[model samples]
Target: ADGYDSGGSDEREFADAWLMRAHGHNAVDLDEIDAAEDALQETQFLLDDFAGLIDDFESQGGSARDLFEIVRQVVNNKKTEAGETN
Candidate 1:
């Protein structure tokens, strides 16, 4: 909220400058927004195993990145087990 606009009119001048730099003199593009949203959703799906990994790590202490690596390994195994990558 400090560096970016959250629709507050009190910072109109700063927000306008930020917008000009962000959008490069072009109108805001909905297609770009949609594509970014779609990419985020896709990444969210891949992290479906994150919750389980956190629980597992809590029970057996290890680095957080280790848990993420374990989740990535499990997901990779599952994908390869089915002979597909999704």
Candidate 2:
């Protein structure tokens, strides 16, 4: 019954998930990993800035920040494991 019904959540989720996978696959490649991390950081910043505006988005759209947080945590976990193995 709101803007989310327009497929915003699905689309954003899809994009974030796809990019997260791409980053994970290339995590060992410093350049790709750094670029992906930077993009994730930017996404988080935007979500934080518009936290209030989300309410205006109808059905209360979810924050991309949450999605980004998951990706970051996952990446860091892998990084930690790599460090431990080294």
Task: Please list the C-alpha lDDT of all candidates, in the order they appear.
Answer: 0.81, 0.75
What ranges in model 1 sit over 4 Å off? 1-24, 50-86
Q: Give model 1's TM-score versus the native structure.
A: 0.32
Candidate 2 per-residue lDDT over residues 1-86, each given as its tens digit: 66554467888888878898888675567798899999999999998877656555434666657756877888889989888532
Clashing residue pairs in all predictions, respectively, total 0, 0
Residue 61 error for model 1, in Å? 14
User: Can you give the lDDT of residue 75 in candidate 2?
Assistant: 86
Cα lDDT tens digits for candidate 1, 24-54: 6788789999999999998887676776666
Which structure among the candidates has the greatest lDDT? 1
RMSD of each candidate? 12.8, 23.0
Cα displacement (angstroms), candidate 1, residue 86, comes to 27
Error of 1 at 11 (Å): 36
TM, every model:
0.32, 0.30
Q: What are the clashing pairs of model 2?
A: none
